[model samples]
Target chain A: MLAFKLAFKNIFGAGYRTILNIAVLSFAFVTIIFYNGVIDGWNQQARRDTIEWEIGQGQLWHPSYDPLDYFSYQDAHGPIPEGMREEVSAGRLTPILIAQASAFPQGRMQGVLLKGIPPGQAILKIPTHELEAQDGQVPALIGKRMAQSIKMKEDDRLLLRWRDKNGAFDALEVTIAGVFDCNVPTIDGGQVWLPLAQLQEMLGMPGEATLLVAGEGFTPTGNTGWAFKDHDYLLADLNKIIQSKKGGSGVIYGLLLIIALLAIFDTQVLAIFRRQKEIGTYIALGMTRWQVVGIFTVEGAAYSILAILLGALYGGPLLWYLGKVGWAMPSGSQDMGISIAEKIYPVYGAGLIITTVLLVVVSATIVSFLPARKIARLNPTDALKGKIQ
Target chain B: MESIIQIKGLTKQFPVGAGKFTALRDISLEFHRGEFTGFVGPSGSGKTTLLNIIGSLDTPTEGEVTVLGRSIAHLTHKQSAQLRNQHLGFIFQTYNLFPVYTVYENVEFALLLQRLPTAERRKAVLDALEWVGLTDKMDSKPAQLSGGEGQRVAIARAMVKRPAILLADEPTANLDSKNSHHILQTMKQLNEELQTTFLFATHDEKVMGYLRRIISLEDGRVVKDEEIIMDKITEG
Candidate 1:
């Protein structure tokens, strides 16, 4: 208790020096929490967007289908199993037929993926209802990114060519029924959506699908001639990307902590060096050498405590405001080939704050103790004389 | 006339380069309660060394020294600290007050080590400050005080706990003659009123004039041990 009292007195008595150290430490404290909070928020936003716009609760893929390998689209799909046909009709599962195709817009050839889904499907957030044929023309939906690249808009006509299962090529004039805006780049760029019946007829493959998306809360059972992919498997890539970003941010955290701790370490060393007489005075006043060490160690740890108070003074309101208004990501972020939204609101968990507090306080204490241990070896007589030991 | 500090054949040595330099040779002494005693000598005469052993700040190389009935040589670090905290007090020439603490806090520090109760501690601190006539400067930091005031605060700090023995090493070395005499008179009065054994190591003549007993040393050995007749000398 005496050590704590004296430590606080000494720290406050130090005046501006104490404030400077606290400022640096508080910077580290607030920066760490804010950076991690932003990353966590981005991860959460990306995960939700991917789930809502692309993968629902999970997915079921055809046995031979490989989403990453474009050549698999040629022969990856098969007839939908009889057991899952009821699920498809009940809207619990939505089947999608994908084919590698080419589109000619303004006489410019561009390769695209033609995905066919039920016009009235409600499993995903895509504007598939606009895919209903109108006025003897095939109506299709494209993402804003795809529409921008093709220079096509609603009601614009484009020539789409694809090969059927019999190696026969077919061409058709499709009208752009709608252009939807989506944050998930993988679901947006280079993709066009059309009615399942039209694509199936064009490909001469009826009742066939490349994949099945399970709706919210839907659980797969029995044989469906397809592999059930759970959320963990479906979101593995996204999780890996998030983890990688966190790893990169870890370096910044380390550098910040090291800088703050280095300042504290230097101050501790200097205090011990200059306060020899005061140390001797404590010994002379009946304090044990260990007690003297405790005073110095607590003095250093007290910096972190002060910093926590200082950080909360300014950082609290700033963090709260940021959480409210969110951070707007710069334009063209969608082209990074990963899921990111326009604005991300940071999520600061109780665990993050507690863990950060412990990390800083514990680190400050250890650095303080390192230099204070030298006091145990100090000769009281020499210290009284203000002689270096 | 109770012997509270007893020393017999004490020797202290320090390492200088490869060889050991003996600071204090075989020496024996006894200090009774309430006596105003001073160890007088020139530089390198081992005055401070002998005082340090009595204060339990340093141990003897070869002797049995006892302070307040505990063997100084055998006392562990904690026991030595307890001995100092409970029964002994120390004052240094440099007035080693904690620069950050105020005069009241400095005086209260010794009593704090004893963990005195709050009301009692406050009373004791105020009384100690009153003794040094520093009640008006209780809130002033050491840096704000003059050298004499600083030394007086150090004296108050040493006396706050009312220890059985007070060891002062050149307490008035940094003071002018007037301030030195004033500090000595205050200490002499405290010694008389409280019967607290006052032991000082100094070469200052002003301090020697106030001692009831003087032990002079030359080269590491006691050269003269005498009792002063206070009535023969006029008050300064």
Candidate 2:
């Protein structure tokens, strides 16, 4: 402890050098913090969009559901297991039947996959539904592109006709309660969400659903796949499926780590050069050679700690701002206009910050080792003579 | 007086390129407790090398240096450091004060080497400072003081720990005549009052005149070992 205190005092003793070294480290700190924040924010945004679109916190599939299966929903049957319902008792689960169908809205028709959702339960899961300006009545939300194709609006009438299992035309009257907008333009243009009861009646399956999509924070002990638990997992899976074609955050983070290592190395090497005489003096005064090495290593560690503190002070607020106003990606289709969130969400995780600080300090200290060793091997007479090599 | 430092035919060699140069040839010397002794030699006469051997800064190539009954020739580097801390004090001609430390802090460094308690160290340091008549300038840094004041601080540092032996390498080389005389008197007073052994390497005549025993060397070999017999009139 006494040696550590002495080292600390010596570092601060050279006031101008300490300040200059910190300034150089600060530049690296800002670069690393901003890069980490942006990548993390984008990842979180993708997860949010994924969970909002398809999978909820806990998704239940059959015990036979394949881990590598892309067509599980098409082969599955019935709604969620009875026990799974009790697990998420506080949050509602929406049973959905997804099937491809040919729709003729006004004689110019196209094939669209109609996802029959449990209407009342889905209201709590969709972001728009939760934030709707309701006036004492529940509204059926239809995508903007679906409304535009049928030339419909709120209170407008539309006829959705599809062929059933028996090859007979099954038609229904769906009132356009409201027009909805999600950032994914392709899904918005082709997808239509209807009440499960209405779909069952039209297709003549009185009380059955093919798939179940729950909201965030659902847990099922028996069986589940592609499931989400809390915000982080949901974001991870969401980023995986939604932004699969774009550049990933892992590459960006790797590059950022390299830059951080180089910056810390440069700064620590400079600091070692400036304190050459002092280190030699300490060694000549009966300090162990390793003790001399330890003092500078500790100084490097202190630099990392200070940089992390400063980075957190700035990065926290920056992430919060990004979460409030996320960025957008351009959509290739006119009808299905693609735009991600305007600003990405920030995650204030303690583990990530600590790991980053440790990484920076360890690399910087290792870089400073060559100089520390050189000082330890210095002849006492040469040191007292003030000769530099 | 019992011998505090015993040397047996010590030698040191320095490598210059492919050939080896002898810095100190086979020679032996002893330092007794409570003695004021001086080693006088010309430049490159191996005075500094001999001093370093006694101070445990350099190892002998052929023989052993036993200080306080411990063989330093075979001790590890760490053990040598421990030995120096426990039994040795050094005053350099450059005054080697840590530029960032005040005179008080510089003096306290020696006591800290002994690992004494803070209160005891403070008392010892202040007392040493008073002994050198630099108590009024204890708070001043070496850069803020004259060359003489800096040398006095170095003296206080060497004496503060009250080690078994103090090694001084040309302690008055940088000081003027007046400061040199004052420093010599202060050292003599310390030797008489504290009964501490002082060993110095010097080329100055003033330093030789103040010593009770002088050993002169040329070509890395001792040429004369003179003991000044004190008379009653000369003592005054």
After superposition on all C-alphas, the RMSD of every candidate to the true structure, in Å, is 1.5, 5.9
Against the hidden true structure, what lDDT does model 1 obtain?
0.91
Give the chain A TM-score for each candidate: 0.96, 0.65
Give lDDT tens digits, candidate 1, residues B1-236.
78888999998999999999998899999989999999999999999989888989999999989998999999988899999999888989888888888999999999888988999999999999899999999999999999999999998999999999999999988899999989998998999899999999999988888888899999899999999897843463
Which residue pairs in candidate 2 have backbone atoms (N, alpha carbon, C) closer than 3 angstroms, thus clashing? A47-A235, A57-A215, A185-A336, A325-A343, A326-A342, A326-A343, A326-A344, A327-A342, A327-A343, A331-A338
Candidate 2 chain A minimal-lDDT segment of 10 residues: A123-132
Against the unseen true structure, what C-alpha lDDT does each candidate score?
A: 0.91, 0.67
- Candidate 2, residue B8: the lDDT equals 85
lDDT of 1 by residue, A126-178 (tens): 98889877888899999888888889999999899999998898899899999
Q: How far out, in Å, is residue B98 in model 2?
A: 1.7
Worst 10 residues of 1 chain B by lDDT: B227-236
Relative to the real complex, the DockQ score for model 2 comes to 0.33
